[model samples]
Target: MGATPATRPTSTPRGLARVGDRVSFLYLERCVVSREDNAITATDDSGVRYIPSATIGVLLLGPGTRVTHQAMSVLGESGAGVVWVGEHGVRYYAGGRALTRSAGLVEAQATAWANRRHRLEVAREMYRLRFPDADPAGMTRRELLGGEGDRVKAAYRAEAARTGVRWVRRTYDPGDFAAGDTPNQAVTAAAQCLYGIAHSVVVALGCSPALGFVHSGHERSFVMDVADLYKVAFGIPAAFDAAAEGPEDIAGRTRRALRERIRAAGLLDRAVADIQHLLAPYRRADEEAAGGKAEDGTDGGVRLQTDRDGTVAGGRNYGAEGVW
Candidate 1:
């Protein structure tokens, strides 16, 4: 008989305390993922092994992983990002929802990103964080983009010199991974790893990855925006170091190195903090201006209170509270 949905636990799992603790996991092998007790377990040919769902940032379900609904519920509640990817983590197929229940953060994100002046300010802040020595306040959007491109090129050269890796043009064909040279492959792999990590944080923070300030239109625009901030610090150097190794399994090696670098840099936590920092100004302004007291007995915060007539209380509509 197949395993039925297990009873949801009342007490929180110990692993839940480890939320936002680790970076991500890539499940390359075929396995059956389920929930046992309060934890998640993966049963394969070897045996049943427990997976700490709460601590993991991204769960990359590559080929051959069958996840049960119960396991997914546990993961979702634990605030983990569940993603389906192709072999070697090349292509992204689908992603699950975030564990955060609050829509406040995402609403703030949309409000800031939708406003022209506010979006520009956020973009400038993002650029300023990456290049602290430079003042982006005086620069226009076009100028900022040009400056960032130039800085990235300089960073590539610096990494190449530091690692003694040959500096060549970045060439890659996503559909045909083998078409790229060793360094190019390494760079691509490192970048893919970073994207997965960044996406996990973006989802966990209850923000829309599709909505972005500096990067626009793409489904993972916000992911790209956040990942770019750490590319110079982590991805570039990792690719260079990996390229300096034996030609065999360069991508795998690069991924492993990138994982280590992510941990050392505390990237999972940093990504969450960065998103909050980038969107904080808007949230602060909204709170100060409109998120006043609610009839629900909350103060200096946004709360929804309704009367028996099914209308908002406190003599304030949703608009007055800036919640809409």
Candidate 2:
């Protein structure tokens, strides 16, 4: 006879911690991940270490990491994001679940994105957040793009001067990471890390990564927009600091430094607040216009679309209304 199987508990949204309250991300590699009741175990040459599944916001599976199906299922149930990345944050492969049950925020995003005026307003808000000293009001998209470019270039020069690293213009060859200097390598590594973090938050909030205001024509356009908001505060400084140490392991050092900076700054919490703020008006309009349908997406049920912004129950046959 076959042996009996162990029972696994299912996790619900209310049972898991909020995204802002959990760890930003945990990076693992060269280990086998498997489920152990409510926690996941990472086994390697060292030993087995158990991590609470519900406490993690994002899990970065680096090179050589092998995760079992049961482990992935548990992570999905806990609403934790999983991202497959390169050893030193050089590449990104794919992403896992959206970790949301309701479609309120995404609906709001789409509604605002569909209108040209609303889209431009959101873009201006993003720039306003980035450049608090300057006013982006009544600025055209072309002006916003120019100002952003100048600000970023100024940031690069400032970091280079502070760290005494040879500063050339930003250059990145995705096919060859080593072609760039130490600062460039570090910057790229830090940028990838920030992107991963931003993506996790975006998906968790039930927003579409492809629908972006400041950036467009990319699958991760919204992810890039969110990540750029923190580049000056976290990514650029961390990269320069790592490069100043030496080029021995610039990428690894950058990741570590960036992680520390993110944690110290409580960036996850701030990011959550900023995203909510950016979409608050749309969310309110959705709620008022759609009768409180724009909630935080913990309904755990699906709905069908009806005429005039109404929803009907899902998984039912409505064939009784005859008229072929």
Candidate 3:
């Protein structure tokens, strides 16, 4: 016989903390994840540890990790995204949903993307954030790309000089892990981690990951766009620091350094605010009219769309009114 209601686990995500207030992401491997009431139990040879599902923003499952259905269900209810990555975050396999139930932010994103002038303006704003000292207001897309390339190269050189690590051009082979040097491996690891974090934030805010201002023709273009804004400040330096420490276990060391940097910088909070700011002009005013808060939805409720940019109560017998 099936379990009774009182014995079943709670599936509602009500009263959970906001995603911006949680950890950026948690990386785990070589462990089994199982459900333990509201928290998840990670079991390994070292023993079991309980992690509150609602406190996680993103859970990165690296190679050798196994997760059960019950654990995933609780995570989904808590509005946490789950990303499956290769060892050292070399490749991304799949991703899960974020914490939002409303479509306000995505509508805003689509509106801005469909307009040429607004799209370019958003792209310029992104570049401005990347290079706070420069003005990208009047620059074209090509100009922005050129400037970004130059700045990135300069950042690489600066980090190498500061860390006393010999650096060359970035290189990576998807099939072969040892083709690149220690620095390249570290950089790749850092970039992948940043991508996971950005993906989680974008989805958490109900934004489309494919709608990008700077990048195009990729599924994760928007993720790339958002992650690049902090490459100079977070990813590169962390990678270089890990490489400087030692070449042994560069990927592990890089992840540790990057995690610390992300926490110290309060990256989750900053990312949430920056994204909202960039898409502020396009935010739908009707979001509030739909009976939800602008900052993440209220209770993840469902509503029906109506004509003239309006929303109505869902789960009704409207078919009798000829409005089916």
Q: Which pairs clash in the backbone of model 1?
A: none
Tell how far residue 109 is off in model 3, in angstroms. 0.7
Question: Which run of 10 residues does model 3 get worst, by summed lDDT?
Answer: 288-297
Better of 1 and 2 by lDDT: 2
Clashing pairs in 3: none
**Per-residue lDDT tens digits of candidate 2, residues 1-324?**
422124444555567788888788888989999987778999999999999987887787878999998888778777677877674336674454555566667777887888999999999999988889989999999999999999999999999999998888899888788888889998988888888889888887778989999899999888899999999889999999999999997877888898888888899999988887788778634343544332334443566666556665556667857222
lDDT of 1 by residue, 1-324 (tens): 544445444323332544356646554458888887556888889999887666677776756889888888777777666766554427774354555444556877998998999899889999988888989997899999999999999988998898888878888776877778788888887887778778877876678998888999999999889988888889989998999885688877888888888878787777778888888776634343444334453433334444431223344445555532
RMSD of 1: 5.1
Q: Give residue 93's lDDT in candidate 3 (0 to 100).
A: 47
Best by lDDT: 3
lDDT of each: 0.74, 0.81, 0.83
TM-score for candidate 2: 0.87
List the RMSD of every prediction in angstroms.
5.1, 3.8, 3.4
Off by over 4 Å in 1: 1-6, 9-15, 24-27, 30-32, 43-45, 63-66, 87-89, 284-302, 305-324
Off by over 4 Å in 3: 1-14, 288-291, 294-324
